[model samples]
Target: MKKIILLLTLITLVFSSMPVNEAVAKSKYKKISVSATAYNELGRTATGFDYRKHPTAKAIAVDPRVIPLGSKVYVPGYGYAIARDVGGRIKGKIIDVHFKTRKQAIKWGRKKVKIRIYRK
Candidate 1:
């Protein structure tokens, strides 16, 4: 029984010491042009995460066909954000960024921006 326990402990240690694959740890992204807008809604996003209490400031609404949900994206003027929300008029190549206030959202207005989207 003691020998069996020691072997099991050794096996566990070996498995835990193994390195994770770099490819799996890193994400590959593609660049695309999108029309960007801003919003300040304080409710839950389409991902079921509260917009007011989300962990990252990088939250944006995206069209599923253009950029899938949960994708990490880097918007030029908006910085880095995750595609966590969607909108009715946000179809095609349009994206909506989230802000803390309506004034900030309005300040962004509408413009064309280059965004890098991570491929799942």
Candidate 2:
């Protein structure tokens, strides 16, 4: 009887402590057509922070109206990034990802990709 009560109490505590949304609260993302480009860290970003010292090395310039600043995004070929910078040409669905060198940026060139914008 004591063992049964202890088991029930333990089970209740475990279930109560577990987040109800832990399994169901996955981040919802919206897919959008984006003109993807790359930029080097030679200059400062529009955010007033030096490009090289940006929190995420994978910084992306995006039109605030389209993706908003300080957003988390996922680019197909470029993996994960934060929308932290902006440029004159980076309007609408266009995005400019930062790289370490001009050669690397040039290698990326320009292309169209579907990026996922995290909604959480």
What lDDT score goes with residue 104 in model 2? 83
Whole-model lDDT per candidate: 0.87, 0.84
lDDT of 2 at 95: 96
Question: Pick by lDDT: which candidate is best?
Answer: 1
Give candidate 2 regions above 4 Å deviation.
1-27, 54-56
**Candidate 1: residue pairs that collide:** none
> What is the C-alpha lDDT profile of model 2 across 1-120, one tens digit per residue?
999999999999999998868336764778999899998865666666675555347879999999988889999888898887888888798999888888888999999999999863
The TM-score leader among the candidates is 1
Evaluate model 1: give its lDDT: 0.87
The TM-score obtained by model 2 is 0.71
